[model samples]
Target chain A: MNIEMIRAAQARLEGHARRTPLLNSPFLDEIAGRRVWVKPECLQHTGSFKFRGGWSAVSGLDPEARARGVIAFSSGNHAQGVALAASRHGVRSIIVMPSDAPQSKIDNTRALGAEVVLFDRAKDDRNAICARLSEEHGLTLIVPYDNPLVIAGQGTCGLEIAEQASAEGITKADVLVCCGGGGFTAGVALALEADAPCLRARPVEPEDFDDMARSLASGVIERNSRLSGSLCDAIITPQPGNLTFPIVSRLAGPGLVVTEDEALHAMAHAFSRLKLVAEPGGAVALAAALFHADEIEGEDVIVTISGGNVDADVFRMALDKFGG
Target chain B: MNIEMIRAAQARLEGHARRTPLLNSPFLDEIAGRRVWVKPECLQHTGSFKFRGGWSAVSGLDPEARARGVIAFSSGNHAQGVALAASRHGVRSIIVMPSDAPQSKIDNTRALGAEVVLFDRAKDDRNAICARLSEEHGLTLIVPYDNPLVIAGQGTCGLEIAEQASAEGITKADVLVCCGGGGFTAGVALALEADAPCLRARPVEPEDFDDMARSLASGVIERNSRLSGSLCDAIITPQPGNLTFPIVSRLAGPGLVVTEDEALHAMAHAFSRLKLVAEPGGAVALAAALFHADEIEGEDVIVTISGGNVDADVFRMALDKFGG
Candidate 1:
């Protein structure tokens, strides 16, 4: 996918999805020691940026294929995204989500009129489950981050960031994107590289699940051995996507990682100052902006808060511990 | 306050504050039985609509008056707002706050560079304190609301709502405004009356603290007997402001009131669906939108989320009780 494809995705998404706002806080700027523009994709459909890719993929499907429905495997955000997108297209959807996923995610996905097939997180293979289910149901499998159209779809967010930044007269800047399978980060980077060459993308992740960061540094695809317990569960991909890695490697800088505590602090700050609900995973990039301020390359920065679907318990804990 | 004064306030606040987005969600709309556009003043500077009024009041002051600084008496959002507004103008601020106010609010106000004077909530009269301080130190006392400039400043939010609704091709609408001293509601109503006569403002309040509702009905300033114990501490004004009551009574509908539980549910819904952090007081209008949907008189509606200075424990309880 190139600039044209990304622009096509942006046009396709125009009326279908929201153009989430770029938020700014003078107080937050004081904290980060720089001017920061926050893109709240938490306000996106399905409460995450995954909705962009899901909608893009679903909407791009042929009439017959769309009528037959689609299938995807994700523990939370992606599942809800695909389910909502398919429902919007008047298509049936079957989502293979982990049984251990938050009850809210499962319930919300099901509420969107999708059939939820919950597999055991510890034992069942989600990929295998999705494959067998898709084949049996004759459904198109919507890979979360590995498709060209989906990559282009996610690229629209980057397009907005670049457009918004440029509109704000920010020419030389860096965007800190929270990374999962490198889909969002790669797409954003490619769009920025193509459209606004002055802006750069910096991938951010939680400490242990920093495969994208390591991969960017090592100039190769690096993998995380364990991802079962990271606080930033939304962006805990084992490794960067095959389609996304190349674009990310070429267009983005070395990844930035923040600790669990820093992410919690970022979430708290978002709650008290920005007045936005930022899930811990969604706030990693914010953590990078606030805590790793010195490491970021530019004066003007964009921090992508990618999702807001935190468990009530975890959110309460963050508020209690890091509030004030 | 008239449209011209409100426009002047808007012009004065152009480069200083945020024009917070008017958020919409299909899910929230479904719950309300109509298309509901949420104006989250939660995103305003100092995390509430008070900043608009504060900035308006402070900026409207003469150069010499601004140089001498200002004094305000409040426990939470308004204090912080005045402090922040004063700080922005390079003016010194002295806030007389109750000792029982949340530590977070007090800390945030101080952090914004205000000198905080803590008085006992039960024993001390904040009005007397402010009066004495203003007279003794020659400081201009910035009333939280009631003032014409502050009301005009807050009217900018109403103008934005009307303009946004018109932009979306909505001509007839009901705007649910959370009511405390009626300043915001009256200002918004007056603005809507002048600019977008097709739109109407509806004042919403907590169940027992329905002074605005009763006052609107009786054409008198009805006061709440108990003020300090309501969960919505931010908007627990004893009665509608002397200056603001007449406008609100004449312009708004019979005020809508919601139960505490409904307000808490609104807060939880805001956290999960709108991905906005709304304090209980802020969520009152949302409660009216969600729980009192039938009473709201238009297909196109606007819900004002007034503030987001909730205590961590209160927010946690809301999330736990009503969060998905």
Candidate 2:
């Protein structure tokens, strides 16, 4: 919500989080026709920047509240992030995921010391299920994007980008961030506003899941007609969070969107040039930076590769399509 | 090469080389049954630690010699490393490679501002070709692993490891390095000997191309029977370097070798757990650390992913074989 709160989250995250490298390649620079600096958050703990928000929210909880445990409703990156954070914090984490979720996701969550509670997405309301579970266990719901602490935690990435950019003598650039429910976008925009005033944050999304882009264009909250089917499943929320939308609207640059193919292509480039694995959602910002260069301004551009918790087959498909 | 020379290279490489991150995963730790820290040199410039040695050798040249440029004979990581290094230093680079080498490799070297001279592997002597090119162009030969300054450059990676390990409170551990002609292994060993004496460097190689290992066991330089068939082609040198062998033998712990299958399996794990794109040659040290855990003597192990220049098909095959 604020720079102080984000700084506080960064204090909690010290040593616990990996201050991932700002990766670049001449190949990428040539392709984009500009200086491309990549913040590979895929290399972060839990293979995603989600770990930052997870740790922030969990660690920010009061001692008594923290002792009761926490719950998250996700079958993807957030589940693993919260699971690991809670385990590291020595508290039980209950993850509510659809039974239809990939077995790897279920297994990975459990492996991170979380109690996996599966629900039928088609027949059961996940929110209702989470509410009941939270009530029964006296657990705090670790909202994925809507919470203040979570936004502050995600803001830590923005803080890193600001410092790293300054170190590279980059004072001004458009920072493309892959957006799900706008927590990362809003957090980064706030941090950049406070720390690196000239570096602007822009939300990037998949073509069909461009609710943030649409919302920014319309100057109001917008919703996606459909989700779930995108290759960028890690960031396919139906709508931007109310808490995050206001902040993004106020401080962020216009949102950008890339097609699924573009995201996969960016994933391949990330693999071949940056030597980093990036999930489709994680690669959307990079996709925008590489393919949508005309829409962006400035000589230098920064992009956040948010996660790499991708399935092997999907990653192979990406490489096959784009030739790593 | 001693630590002072390494420190000098570090000074010359202060802003040019990437200080790649030390990445880890609980999943990898569980598999290794010990804490595993991966120094991902694959994320270094030109997607390998070779850049360190390349820059060291090129930058250490006298003004007249540097202006005359540099030449190297490699179809893989070294070619790219030296090419990029020379280009950045505003000097011409000539790379002599086998005509049968992958076209991608040839094209990539050229794209990095290097002049590529192809020769027949069966009939042409690459060393003679390089010698001719060097004389014709008044170019200093940038030996891949044998030069003192090259070793000093690679030693900078060791310096980083010692500092990072100390920051993590790791005083003692085996630092597994993917070894070819022993340049990287020797450099790291010399640096660790001075900085973190408790951290011992060990050379890792592919099964058949284990010249470094055999040389260490015999307490003398030894040669491989053949070098072209290994999947880890980047490290398929015929023999250990004369300059590197003595330092490695004196300062290094021992040598480790892993099978092609093990390297591929480790590559899969790196992609899955660490979100790193590690080629088979690069993954050998990680393979040794994970599958050869019993052979190692420590609760913590540090492995370097030497390079990530594998073809897309090869990376997919690795994933298919091991399930990333």
Candidate 2 residues A1-324, lDDT tens each? 688999999999999988988989889999999999999999999999999999999999999999999999998999999999999999999999999999999999999999999999889999999999999999999999999999999999999999999999997899999999999998999999999999999999999889999999999999999977899999999899999999999999999989999999999999889889999999999999999999999999999999999999999989989974
Give candidate 1's error at residue A15 in angstroms.
3.0
Error of 2 at B62 (Å): 1.1
Q: Write the per-residue lDDT of candidate 1 for residues A1-324, one digit (tens) a residue.
A: 788888888887887778888888777888889898999999888889999999988888888888889998887888888898898888999988888777877888898779999899789877888889887878999988888878888899999988888879998988999999988988899899887999999899999899998998988899998978888998998899999999999999889989999999999989877888888999999999999988987777899999998877788878988974
* Cα RMSD, each candidate: 2.5, 1.0
Fraction of true A-B contacts recovered by candidate 2: 0.88
Query: lDDT score, residue B198, model 1?
Result: 92
* Sliding window of 10 residues with minimal summed lDDT for model 1 chain B: B17-26
What are the per-model DockQ values? 0.64, 0.80
Q: lDDT of each structure?
A: 0.88, 0.94
Error of 2 at B217 (Å): 1.1
lDDT of 2 by residue, B35-148 (tens): 999999999999999999999999999999999999999989999999999999999999998899899999999999999999998899888888888898899998889899
True lDDT of residue B17, candidate 1 = 73
Colliding residue pairs in candidate 1? none
